[model samples]
Target: MLREVTAIRYVTPLREGGSLPGVVEADDLGTYVVKFRGAGQGPKALVAEVISGELARRLGLPVPDMAVVQLDPVVARAEPDEEVQELIKASAGANLGMDFLPGALGYDPVAHPVEAGLASRVLAFDAFVENVDRSWRNPNLLIWHNALWLIDHGATLYFHHNWPRAEAVVHRPYKWDDHVLKPYATALATEGPALAARLTPSLIREAVDLVPDEWLDDGGKDAYISHLTARAAEPEAWLP
Candidate 1:
């Protein structure tokens, strides 16, 4: 289970993508970029974030530490923005929080050249998860302490949004032409297969298990495990 922290203060709104994630101070004295469940994407996005982020961590990828934030609607009282206050009130219970990277900079492919092997691994991982958000125009990456860190995985595993069509698209081919790291992922032919081999059913299940029970209210744990395991089993179909 993830460490649980209660949100103690509502910091500034990030105002990034549509979800409107915000910086928040928690009881643990840590600042987190919390993704509110009341956001447009709803709890399923949080579920994807937890599962995919944890899976990346387990696969030896760099990711910010995650915690389940216990939020109280009262924290919204100080917020100046009515929109933000409403969001906080709606997401009063559990939300997903990623430890804030203090001095991290958004990844720029030219400014921050990534090594071929790491890029390959990242590409392969994204392909496996069907993450369509890591395009060149909007690479959801950060350069922290001279290393690459993956973030904002809520866009992955989109098949869950339509369960009936999941099987048909589980092994769908990944179009890598526009992937931000594609140019640097020269070792994908080798690293891709190697990474796929590591995505065992047990590992997938372990990642899925990390998601909060409330997020899995749809009872989709088994479905996630099965879909990921099946996709992992046939890397050739999805590896870019």
Candidate 2:
């Protein structure tokens, strides 16, 4: 397990992250892509990344290891971009880290280069489950050591925005066009009791608990917990 340590030296900000992600090196010699929480995107975004990434790994997806990291002023040399400096400063205390995938260029789904057909299937599962973050522009796919690696799964399940009365099942299960995963799409949609069983209440609870308190008020937390509990109970709606 990675230790919960505070303070990492910021190396450089990732140009693609819309002026928010600061790449850094932890004292342990691990490179990290750190994100701040002050963007009003909230801590739930970070929680989503950790939970989804971990769960996908359990389901046999190749996700790089991830952890929350703290940024120290002594190490980071950040000049204000003037546009979003306040948000950055406010989030100074709540920085997050994604274990960096060095020497990897962003994946272009158009090229369909991911050799692992399984990755496409897994990503299809992600899409069917309504993971809103994995788009072609910021596919969050990485290529490391000649193997496809996935990262940054924070934006997902956007329906939570409306706070509709939590309903688990939508009539049609994901059709899962295999073409979306290969030379066309590599992953095929698969359904099984085992994968369904994996999305448990305890796991959801734990994943929700990982979010920082500052991001959610007591009421928000209670509502999220309630909704997640209900959602987990009807696992077929999500995993199928």
The most accurate candidate by TM-score is 1
* Model 1 segments more than 4 A misplaced: none
- Give the alpha carbon lDDT tens digit for every residue of 175-232 in model 1: 8789999989999989999999999999999999988888875646998999999999
Give the per-residue lDDT digits (tens) of candidate 2, residues 69-186: 6654545446555434454566656556777877887777666555445654564547434565555646677777877776777676444555553444332244333323434442
Error of 1 at 188 (Å): 0.6
Cα miss at 78, model 1 (Å)? 0.7
Among residues 3 or more apart in sequence or in different chains, the pairs in candidate 1 whose N, CA or C atoms overlap within 3 Å are none
Which whole-number lDDT from 0 to 100 does residue 127 have in model 2?
A: 46
Where's the lowest-lDDT run of ten residues in candidate 2? 171-180
Candidate 2 off by > 4 Å: 1-3, 72-80, 110-117, 164-194, 219-226, 232-240
CA shift of 234, model 2, Å: 4.6
Q: Which lDDT value does model 1 have at 152?
A: 97
RMSD of 1: 0.9
